[model samples]
Target chain A: MKYLPYILKHLRKNWIRTASTIAAMALCIFLIASLQTVLAAFYGTIDTAATDRLITRHRISLAEDLPMAYEARIGAIAGVKRTAKTNWFGGVMGSSGGQPDMRNFFANFAVDAEPYLAMYPEYGLTDADKQAFMQDMRGAIIGPALAEKYGWKIGSTFQLESIIPPYRADKPFEFVVRAIYSVDTQKYPNHARDMMLFHWKYLYEKTGQRAGVGTYSLQIANPSQAAAIAKAVDSTFENSDTQTKTETEAQFVASFLALVGDLGLILNAIGMAVAFTILLVTANTMSMAIRERRTEIAVLKTLGYPSALVLALVLGEALVIGLLGSGLGVLMASTLIGNLGSIPGLQGFGSVAMSAGLAAGMFAVGAAMGLISGLAPAVGAYRANITSMLRQV
Target chain B: MAAVDVQSVRKIYKRDSQEIVVLDGLSLEVPEGEFVALMGPSGSGKTTLLNLIAGIDRPTSGKVIVSGTDLTTLSEGPLAKWRSRNIGFIFQFYNLIPVLTAVENVELPLLLTKLPRKQRRERAMTALKIVGLADRSHHYPRQLSGGQEQRVAIARAVVADPAVLVADEPTGDLDAKSAEEILNLLQTLNSDFKKTIVMVTHDPRAACRAHIERHLDKGVLMTTVERHDVAAPVGAR
Candidate 1:
């Protein structure tokens, strides 16, 4: 505590430089934290997935579809508890005449109404919502996320273009949103927060007698029978001209990641590099401050100051810088994330949620940076000689 | 009682890959209440001997005992503490921290004590009053004239109520008038308070005021005189 004045005096000596260094650290850390948030949202989807449920797509790929007739056959099989079928609507509403109206064409599909609700109870939907959705012929149900995205409601109308094949240059498809179904949890919940569902009959009548169905989502009586059912389900369609690759619903969801393909690994590697840079820059700055305080340390020593007190001085200085920089970084990240819609890159991903876990990680990193930077200089002070130190002009 | 004992002190230095001996078997003694001047040519071991007596630097081989403590026997940490309580140093450059006020500069030594802030302030003010600069207590070191700065240094030196005062060319950077005021302050600190003063200077006029005078040359003390003897070492030689 006696040495606090000395540390503060040293800090005040280079106020501008210290302030700038702290600001730079805060910005870099904040950016790094935000990047991690987006990545978390991406990976968090897979981490929080439900294991009991299963999704069966076309033999070859999700873009291809299976016969709607097979839905009954799959349902009739042993251990087949309940099933839902959802087909991609490929809806695209344009933000501009230019930018491909579809928003990277992320995720929009139509599901088998009753079974889709039964198979996924995590959606926390009310029975009234289920009945309202099922009772209407023009009935269409939308995920709450999609309703907020396009501003649709129980009686709201939605019109969008199909990004799928037979894409017309001039025409956009339309759907009257029946009811909005809620989600149980977020797993890769869309960045735009758009999740769509429509009546299978509507798809059949609109795109009438369609060549194929998108994917069949299933929930089984015996959760352990998933692997066998998946295998058997695939073998039944094995030699039917279109080859099949039926993985468990979990694997099916995990496989969708092939689109980004190793990029996340590259991002993680880059994040490690960025973290190291923060350590170096912060360390170099603190070391410089310590070097400059050599004479002051010597002065204290000459005045009968103890070595332990000197050590505390340097460590205290480092901690101040760390706390300031890290605290600033955390504040900026939380503020930016809290007001996510205003941030530039984040607008594409909706409002980013700043998790407590992310903030804790940042604080820990800042403290470590401070300690590492201060270690060398403080040790140097501890070994100073009062005679020559006082002699330094 | 003798305040400082310097016996056969030896000091060496290496500069630009050249070995240079600064003090060789130099011996000097100052009794309590004595104001002695160490007079010599530029590299004549005057400052080196002063350092040894103050317990700041160790002799390469002989005894430097001050105030009943052998400086050579004390380790670096204990030596600093011993020096702070027993010796006061006035540097040629004044050596006042630029950012600190005169009171704060004087209070620096008290930081080593467990005195509360209020007590430290009172003690610092008293020290500054001894040098007749109590009014300038709040003034920063940089704001003071050369003589006033030296007075603050003197206050810092005597603030801890040390047994011995060591000055290394205290008037080296002052003008004649300022230098005279500093000499008067040193004289008052020595005679009025009976603080033992060991001053190292090249100026013969500065040496003239000492109660005893000593000259060092070729790393050894060659001449010494007292009040009954000559006060100017050059004249004594």
Candidate 2:
């Protein structure tokens, strides 16, 4: 503890160099942490997906619509508990009087209320809100994040202009907000928090497209039977014009992310590059500091400090720098991520906040970097010839 | 008993497969509480002998016994521990750590001991007071003058209260006024505190302060002169 003052003074001797090195390390750590957090958020969507639920979409592509009649047929199959249909109602809420430009373009789903709510119990909604949503055909349940964003209340009415021409083209679709739902952010961080769901019957009636849904979500009695059920459901429509591709909910999310690219390989490559750069910069800083203190190190030895103590002192200095830089970097990244949730069009990307596991992993990497960087310089100090060094200026 | 005893010590350096002998079959002794000065020309092995007595270096052959402990018998770790407790060193350059304040540099050796922080600080302060640099304790080596820095180095050397103080050209870098003050301080430490001191120097004025002066040439003792004007040895006192 007493030697801490000495070590600190030595570091402060070259304050500019020390500060620059620390800042460089902090930037590297921030880049690594932010990248890893984004990757974790992408994978988190798959990890928290409901195991017992299976999604049935068009085999050719998700843009193709599936028949709404398949929901009833899939519900009749063994191990099938309940089924719900959802159609994507592409809506854009633009800037209006007394309202700031939400320019809020989001995935608004037209769903069968009762079955969809039952299958997704993670979305917490009040009983009163659920009842209100079920009673009104033109009612919508929006996520709390979306409600706060657009200043929506329980009885408020809002108009969403449909981009798809099949829906009301000249007149915007007006709907009353009936409820606001919340989900566990820790488990489903990447889950779309700014979502709006209205009645599929209302959309079908308004569009005059009587018998089509975009996707079907099936709830199975046993999660272990999901693969068998998905196979049977897909085979049921194998020869038909509207062929189906069925998969577990997790697999569906994974495949959706696969469209982006190979995220794991890219993330690993980025992480390794950042780590190597940090190691080189920190190692150079430590080496320079030790080189300047060669004579002082010899003086310490003449004062009866053992080689091991000198080595520890050098390594401890490196550790302090590493920890300080990494800690600041992570804190800065966390603050940015937390604030990103409030920005428009960035909610989904920002929803993936830094996880505790990743934060801990970053700290460990910082410490390891310090140890690895300091090893060579500390060894050089330890093995220095006290007699020859004393002769040096 | 002798505070420092060197028995036929020899030191050789090897450079590119060629051996250069610095000290050959050199032996010397200084009684407890006696101040001795070694004067010689450049490369006359005075500093080399001082290093052997201080336990900072080992003899090529023969033994170096200081304060009744044979330094050659001890390994590097134990020898360091013994040196810290028994020998205090003052160098030509002061060698004060540039980063530390005057008092912090003095307090360094005490850190190796089991003393609590308060006690260590007090002892360090007391040592600085003895060297009359108590007021400059907070100043760093760069902030102090050459003489003041050397005084702080002296404080650091004596803070551990070692049996013998080894000084190599202690005033070689100081002005005449500062050099005289340092020599007076060394005389006071030897006479009043009864600290046995071994100083290696080329200055005859510095050698006159010691009770006994020894000259060396070619790694061999040339002559020993007793200073009649100086106070009697501690035993006589």
Candidate 3:
């Protein structure tokens, strides 16, 4: 640690060179963290799965529906606890005069409410709340995050009138916000955060569209029994005009992401490139520093500083530089994630909160940079002869 | 016991299969607490002999022993430690670390010691006092005159209390007055503190002050003179 002051002094003396090199390291680290944020946002979605839940959709297409009567037959399965259904409900908000609004929110159709609640208890609804939602025909629930996003209040008649169309772009559906809830978990069981749901009967009866339901959300009696119940649900719809495909909610979430995003490989490639660039810049700085000090290092050796101590000093210099640079990078990266992640172009990925895992990974990378930077200098110092070194002056 | 023992020591330089013999079977000895001048022409292997005795270089063959430890026997790590503790080197060009102030250069050797920072500072000041440059301790080597730089080099050399002081022409780069002052300081360190001093030089006037003068010719000590001898031919005059 005594060497720390010496290192700092050297850095200050070579201010421009040292500053530029550190800036490069910081930029690379910021890039790495930025890429990781994107990957984390996408992976965070898949991780928001519920084992007790299963999704039963059309065998051939996600847009297709089955008879609402199948919910009861599926619920009757030995390991099935509950079943409900929802339509895709793709209506986005439209401003007056036929112009589309920019805000994005989840829109879903539901008839049997209890199963949706049972399968996704992370929605933060209690039994009493479920009973209230079940009893009210015009009742609607929204996540607090979503409520805040759209300025909706409980007991207020919020216009889905702008967003949800009644089978035509010319008409709209409206609802009264009955409850605003937050998911108890960090991730949502269905939408992570941006979701709103209500009684499907209101939309179903008006359209006179009796195409059954788009998808059944199922809750199993036992998590381990999910596979058997999924089989039963598919078996029930097997012979019908529309067959079913059922999967655990986690698998469902993954498949949904696979269909919508190219994140799996993109995140990995971006992460590797970021790490590699940082390594290159740091190694270059270290090489220059060592090369310039060949004679000074020889002086220290002749002065009897142990070769190992000299090596440690160089490594410590690199570590301090890396930690400062990367720490600054993580600070900027977290801000970008928190403030910018919910923009219209970035909305589906949700907020990017800095996690302990990310901090630990950055720390390990910083230490590895230190080790890499010290290697060549240490070898050079070890090989130098004290007499010739003194003669160098 | 001899503070330095050079026995059949040979140093050769190889450049593209050519052998340049800097020292061929050179041998010399110096007992404790003696002020010995190794005088010769520029290519006379004087500095080479000093380096060998200072544990800074290995001979091509044979042995160099200092204070009972065989120089060629110790590995590099131990040899560097030994040099720092036992040998104080004064270079002709002063060779002060440019980044360091006078006091810091003096403190360099103590960095290898277990002394506390305050104590190292105190000892560095005392060494500067020994060279009469305690007032210039804050100035960097570049700011000092050639003589002052040499004095700082001397402070740095003695700061760690090494057993032997090896000066390869300390006054070589100084004016006559400064050179005389440097010679007087070296004499004091010898008679007053009983330090073992070895200096290599071609200057006969500076050579006149040493308690003993030794000549290295063709990698061999030809003679040792304890006092000025009028009958002998002048080595350089």
DockQ of each: 0.39, 0.67, 0.43
| 10 residues in a row with least lDDT, candidate 2 chain B | B228-237
Judged by lDDT, which candidate is best?
2
Q: What interface RMSD do all candidates show, one decimal each?
A: 2.1, 0.9, 2.0
Ranking by DockQ: 2, 3, 1
In the range B1-237, model 3's lDDT, one tens digit per residue, is 998888998999788989888888877788888778999877778998998887777899989988888989998779878988988888788878776789988998888788989999999999999988999999988899999999898888889988789998999999998897788888777666767889998898777777689988867777788874422222211
Angstrom error of the Cα, residue A145, model 2: value is: 3.3
- The numbered model that scores best in TM-score is 2
- Residue A303, candidate 2: Cα error in Å is 0.8
**In candidate 3, how many Å is residue B55 off?**
1.3
Order of candidate numbers by TM-score, starting with the best: 2, 3, 1
The estimated TM-scores of all candidates read: 0.82, 0.93, 0.84
The superposed Cα distance between candidate 2 and the true structure at residue A349, in angstroms, equals: 3.2
| DockQ of candidate 2 compared with the true complex | 0.67
Q: What is the per-residue lDDT of model 3 for residues A152-195, given as tens digits with 9 covering 90 to 100?
A: 88776655542434343235667677777676553553345666
Q: What is the TM-score of chain A alone in each candidate?
A: 0.84, 0.90, 0.84
lDDT tens readout by residue for model 2, A279-356? 998998899999988888888888888888999999989987888788987997788777666566655563457988
**Model 2 lDDT at residue A173:** 73
